[model samples]
Target: MNEKQIEGLLEQHGIKLTANRILIAKVMSTLDYPISMKELETMLLTMDKSSIFRTLSLFKSHHLVHQMEDGNDIVRYELCHSHSEEEDEDIHVHFYCEHCHRTFCLNEISVPQVNLPVGYRQTAVNYMIKGICPDCSHR
Candidate 1:
């Protein structure tokens, strides 16, 4: 998506349009996988640390973004493509490239229902698969 569309999405979440928020959100939206802010910092041209953090906080609060845990504990962020007004959490598969450290959201794969005890609270679900990504495998 273009920057304008991204701006609109951010606005939908009640977030003001700022250069850093737009920049970070654009990069996040463009990703085929969840990515680290460090990788994000590498991709950004003019970014400040506080701005990225604030943007993430806003995005998460609005359910516009979801955090995924890869094996490395980076607390990666990906677009909650399914998030809406009520913010219903769905179970989906995430792919992680060990060599390149990229995480992909596998929307096509859905998680099976699991039995839980009574009064269980499940806010979010994150399931990840790890291997070398195709690009890294050929390299």
Candidate 2:
């Protein structure tokens, strides 16, 4: 997205717009896969590590993005596609490919709804499915 569009989104999510913040958001928008801060650092030509962390912190607070820890044990992030203010803290599925070591959003592969134990409470369900992706499968 352009600066104006990114700025508006940041405002909508009650986040402050900075150059680093906008760049991070833009990279997430461009990718159909989840990415690590390190990956983003390389993608963003002008990013500084500290700035990226701050931007991610703001994004997490506002539900502009979501983080997942795959079996690979890295914290990866992707844009939250839902426009609703609610369910911002809900659990979603993430797909990770071992061969490629890339994570993708499984938006349609939502976590199945089930009853919780009488006294149990749900916070978030982070489910990561690991396998080889199409490209790797072809090799």
The C-alpha lDDT values of all candidates are 0.78, 0.78
Q: What's model 2's overall lDDT?
A: 0.78
Q: How far is candidate 2 from the true structure (C-alpha RMSD, Å)?
A: 2.3
Error of 2 at 99 (Å): 2.3
Per-residue accuracy of model 1 over 1-139 as CA lDDT, tens digit each: 8988888888876778888778888888888777777777777747776778788878888887887789678888887665463473555888888987777778889876777899997777778889988899899
Model 2: colliding residue pairs: none
- TM-scores across all candidates? 0.80, 0.84
- Please state every model's RMSD to the true fold in angstroms: 2.5, 2.3
lDDT for residue 89 in candidate 2, whole number 0-100: 42
Steric overlap count per candidate: 1, 0
Q: Considering every candidate listed, which one attains the maximal TM-score?
A: 2
